[model samples]
Target: MSRTLLAPRSWPLAVKVPLVVAALMAALGVLASWLVLANLADIQERNLRRLADVTLGTLAASLAAPVERRDIWETFDALDRLTATDSGMPAVAMVVLLPGGEVLAASDPRRFPTLRRLDEPLLRAALRAGDMLFDTSRARAVATYRLEEGGEQLGTLLAELDIGALLAERRRATVALVVSNSFLTLVMAGVGYALVRRMLGPLSRLAVAAERLERGEDPGELLEPPQGSREFRKLFGRFRAMARAVQERETILKRLAEEDRLAQLGRLASAMAHEVNNPLAGLLTVVDTLRRRGEDDGVRRHAVELLERGLLGIRNVVGAMLVAYKEDREAPGLTRRAIDDLRYLVQHEVARKRLELVWTNRLPPVLPVDGGAVRQALLNLLLNACGASPVGGKVVFEAVAEDGVCRFLIADQGPGLPADMAAILERSGPPTTPPGRGLGLWTAATLWQRIGGTIRVERVPGKGTRIRLAVPVRVRAEVV
Candidate 1:
């Protein structure tokens, strides 16, 4: 399986933004529902209380004359009339009581039997004290009013209001609220998703464009000038400009690198001329000796051996120098043989400059390194060192492998390291110093970095500068 497939997918803004908005809407919806239901309940309770009080007042007035004459039939008829007129109210039953608290009559005789006196504290409070009483568990409300004739108090009328209708209406309202609120929440969720998705549309394109730029490909449509908000358009414009700048810089660097390679080749050509000339002279002399001594087998054999050795030496030098020029060469493991070959190529420079070249090779037989890159790196350093040294000045080149690291040190007896050279070793890329001053150093640094190596420069005021290139030893087999 691909690594990306195995990895968990990250939540995009498209999903996250909508989810956040939906959560907020849902929370607000719940809050609104609670408030609406609470208010509705309060209104229902108030209306129930009001209806009970009005019914009690009407019943008290109707029963006043009937109760004063103590007429049983008339009292029953008055109770019936009270309930009939209160059809719209939630009055379940009505009872007429005398001052002694005995029920004279009831609208529903079966429900509230006669001779049944409701002398409870709540009933008494409603009749003789408080305005009304309510029982929430039973969903009932009670109220009583005094029945009086002239200055004499006859009896009282008590009405029990059934709040079932209010409860039913509350249930219906809640259902309606739930249905309406849910639909609104869904609508809000859909609208929020579309708005958020549209708002973030440019972000995905920007990401793709950035990736394309990183891969050295044209950003194309992904980074096209955006429409809508000024900020978004400006942001995309900046991205396009940045990508163009990076591409331009990359092209310039590639050209500079190619030029540096050609310069190295030019230096190698000079070294090759000096190196090959001496071998050619020796080979020519051997051929002359072979022809003159053709009659003597022993002399001819010796001449032939000398000729072979001289030709081999010349070939070795030429081959060593050509290693750096090989096109698209793969780097091989570091070896003592490779280092010796590099030293051979630079021997001409040492001779031509007449500098005392102190050569030291203490590296292992084999180490993981790109042979071509390492050789080129060494060539740059040796050339730089040679150029810095005056005639008869000493130059030291040493290599040692210790503690699983290869250390190559080059020191030149010159004025000192230049300020630009110091900056080259201190940081990466083209040095801030003037052109032609730090290219070799920069190239050397670049080479070393490719092989996971570091370069350090140490300089004293009067003494010469010493550069140490340290590379961790990786075995060939361990390399990927």
Candidate 2:
């Protein structure tokens, strides 16, 4: 058993292509933005740290000879000059820490709550641990380095670096990205929609062709797309080729069926006509003898009755065989008669084969249908039915108007066939078993279909089989 769902694959290229492109553009946009952001942020921090390190060393250089207050002031004055030269950089505080947690000369001493206290985490770490450290807090990257003179550690240089430009730069970048992405999205939507539509338009044409085939109508030329992309041409080419192949095969089957039907008529034409002519000629002779002898009224009436019935039966046989020659190929002798009259044609043939006849012709037979075709189809079905039937079985013929079309049923007491065989007859395809190079029911079924009609079979279980044939009376002119 299959557990997965089976589905048809259709990309509807218009939708799939645009979505994939949009997703790719978004990914690339994010990736480029991330790279630029990371570099700008790192550069801001690195530049501020370099400036702090240089300023600290110069201030510490003044105290190289002796650690004194005046020396630190001299160092601080020089650091102020340096800060003026690079004024664009934010104001930074550089503090020197003593080993016992006391701060030396520092920038922005008024900003601190206590001048004697070193509260910076980096500064405290430098004083207590006497180790170099780096820490960041409140948009600042701070670092402390131990200042030494001649392999002897003097104090710790604590530096504060401001790097807020990273956020400002990223904000500007994001604005530019929004504008660029908006423009790209518009272009992708417009161009992508056209590209998808162009690629999928051929499939729409193919759908129309399929519809034509389904309604049994002639299909027009499909797209001949050598003017488009290579893949598109190849795909359309295959569709066109398949449509042509199907149409061609259908045409061949129709011709073969017509020929088979005509051929069968040719073989049976002599015997069938002879069968009707003999009874008809004998009845005519008896009527003439009755007239010449000046017989009583009852005797003349009896002979006339036989003559009328025989002539009616003969007219029906000829009517069914109107298309006996090529001259009658597209002609039909359609006339309305009592539907009960059609039943009489098969009644004799049925009784001769020891099969019961059934039908009362309940509806009016003023149907505008080709009576000849109906008679031909009915006669062929009864003959085939008799071959399958046993002695003293029932054969039924019925007529009615259902859903605005005239339908006829011809059933016989014969062995019912398999479902597959019934399907083949319905399709109008050549028999797989070929009906063995002789006259058979498929031949007649094909001929009936060519003129806007159809034959279908239904099983009657214990009784045997029923073949129902229907033709739209509105199409009578086309059939004729």
Candidate 3:
């Protein structure tokens, strides 16, 4: 998870693009600063070497005659003059040695008295020819030169040059480079951020338009065409086209649903007429018998019994239909009777197919769920199963409430359900209506989803298809 969060690919383009640009600029700045500092240091070192050579050569030529004549005053005077000069090199101290390595004269006489052999490590190390050493710890450079008169070595001169000025200049350059590079990096980063934000403006607007479309609102007039690159304009065009198509499709679906509802109502009306007419015919027979044999006690008793049964049958059929079709908001909570009402509701289709139905209900007397929705969903599933079953085939339906959930199962003994139809039950959201097909299954699935239900389908080869629905039990407050 940390890797996922830190991964650059997952970063938003607004941040990622500017950060990359800033990083590249910083790297280039650092490289440029390093190169400039290195080149400056090299030039400064070269100049220092050249100055050292010139200063030492002049000092050595002047000192050679004085040391050969054993003139301490002249040697001291020459050393003093070299230190006093305002040359670029800051000479701190100088010492002249005789041919036998004895100090002839010194700029600091107390430190190196006359005729005393030079014992200082720094001065002794500089006695070799053409050797220039820089002592960074002390911020000084030491140079040595041998005094010669007509191809004869007179003595040696050692000079210690102060280099604080050169070091100070390099420090100033470093500071300037760092400040300028940092400022440049910040400016470039800000510019990069602005450009990226402007480039993504169209995408942000497109996203808003998409959100509006998702909520089933009209996006065509509300969303302006994006004005940016060709790609962004084309994308907005395609999105507008898709939104129109979606709106049209939804309009057609609503129309189709209305038609399907009317068709279902017609079928129910026909079934109810058939059921009521049969009982009415029986009532007619009973009425005729009662009128013809009014004084016969056994005939009157049988007539009354038949009248009661026929009226009761008609009432049950009407009541079941009402329960299945009642508005959900006005319907009572789910109950055993509401679940059982589905049996009567689908009886017409069952009879038409000549199928055997084995129904078992083990629910509590009442449940905290929308009874009308459950009834409607179950009615559709039962009707679908009855239609799928071959003549004389068996369809089974079972319902039970347990563990805070109510489960319903319907199985039919016929050819297995098609894969596409089975997918309607297995999908997560509302089932899409196939063109003029699978409307009943779609309605059942949609109703199930409305009540927070899940569906599972199982197909057995050479047998049939089974669908199970599981709905969680809602609380009383939630049911309302």
Candidate 4:
């Protein structure tokens, strides 16, 4: 359920490509800035060290003669001049000390007085640490140089150089690097986004067109040739061809469906004619018999009974056809009569195959279900069973109402249903029609599904196929 950035396809190419470019640029910028800052800091430190060395060496040379003669005023003057003349060195304080660890002269006399031992712990530690020590915490460098004449140790000169300016310069450089790199990264990221979006514009258009096509709407101007590279043009051409093919196929399928419907209607009409003609012929024969024996009460009574049965048979056939084909705002509920009507609808098929139909109806007088849909579905199933049964074979049709549901079962004495047809019945979705075959079963399955009915099929190896349809009694009527 959770997603990660590593799955780039989840993001659009326009965004993903630009984001990757921006991330890579930012990383490179950070690395470059770090390297440049490091190098800049090194250079600044080297220059500061060089300046400190020169200032210290020159100051030591100037103090050598004065310290040997113990001229405190001249030594203090030399230190003062060193600070006044050199702007780069920024010497904070200077001290002249004797070889015996006694301070001879101090640039700040009140703090480090003449002829007093040096007591600055920081300066003492820096002196003991090395000839030149940088105390970055104090933003200063301390240097100690021995003032010698002819290789004789005359005295020592100590100087503290202020390095705050160098540190500030480095800070400014860092800010500049950061600002420049950020600006460049943003510029490149924006350019990348725009370019990628422009390049993939056709793909976005194609996607929109595809969605429109899927909804069975005309894409029209959406699928028009786009202005871009050759590959996009080719893709658009292929899509147009594909769309044309799809439209053509759909048109053909619609035509085929219309034809199939007409063919089915023709067959039903033929069967109705055959069924009605037989009953009508029998009624005419009975009428002729009654006319010839008008005085015989027995013959008249028998003829009247035959006429009533024949009329009833014709009514059942017509009534079943009307129930199957008629549409109403509110559907009638299922009943025993509707179930029995199916027998009349399929009698023509049963007779054509010379198959014996075993009909059973135990449903209540009325049940809360769409009677039309149920009747039509059962008729289709019974007709299918009759067709599948061989000549002189039995086609069993059973309907029962139990436990708030209506169940209908149809079994054929022929070979078991083909695997594909059985699979269609067993499937929960709308069933697809096999080419020129199994249309009846498909129609039945579709109707059953619309009314929230379930189907179960059992086929025995030595026997035949049994299909059971169960419909909830209280299911809402659905448009079939």
Give the alpha carbon lDDT tens digit for every residue of 183-213 in model 4: 8888998999999999988889989988877
Over 4 Å off in model 4, which ranges? 1-9, 65-77, 95-138, 142-158, 263-480
Q: What tens-digit string does per-residue lDDT give for candidate 3 at 178-277? A: 8999999999989999999899887777777778765556765545665547887788788878888887886776577657766887899799999899
Q: What is the lDDT for 242 in model 4?
A: 99
Score candidate 1 by TM-score against the native: 0.58
Please report, in order, the local distance difference test score of every candidate based on alpha carbons: 0.77, 0.63, 0.83, 0.81
Q: How high is each candidate's TM-score?
A: 0.58, 0.58, 0.71, 0.61
Query: What are the per-residue Cα lDDT tens digits for candidate 2 across 15-85?
Result: 76886778777787778777876787677667666755666666567655544342556545554565566
The most accurate candidate by lDDT is: 3
Colliding pairs, model 4: none
**lDDT winner, 3 or 4:** 3
**lDDT score of model 2?**
0.63
TM-score winner, 2 or 3: 3
The residue pairs in collision within model 2 are: none
Which of the numbered candidates is closest to the native, going by highest TM-score?
Answer: 3
- Which residue runs does candidate 3 get wrong by more than 4 Å? 1-12, 43-47, 50-87, 90-191, 226-234, 283-310, 326-337, 354-378, 390-408, 428-436, 444-456, 459-463, 468-480
Candidate 3 has a TM-score of 0.71
Candidates 3 and 4 compared by TM-score, better number:
3
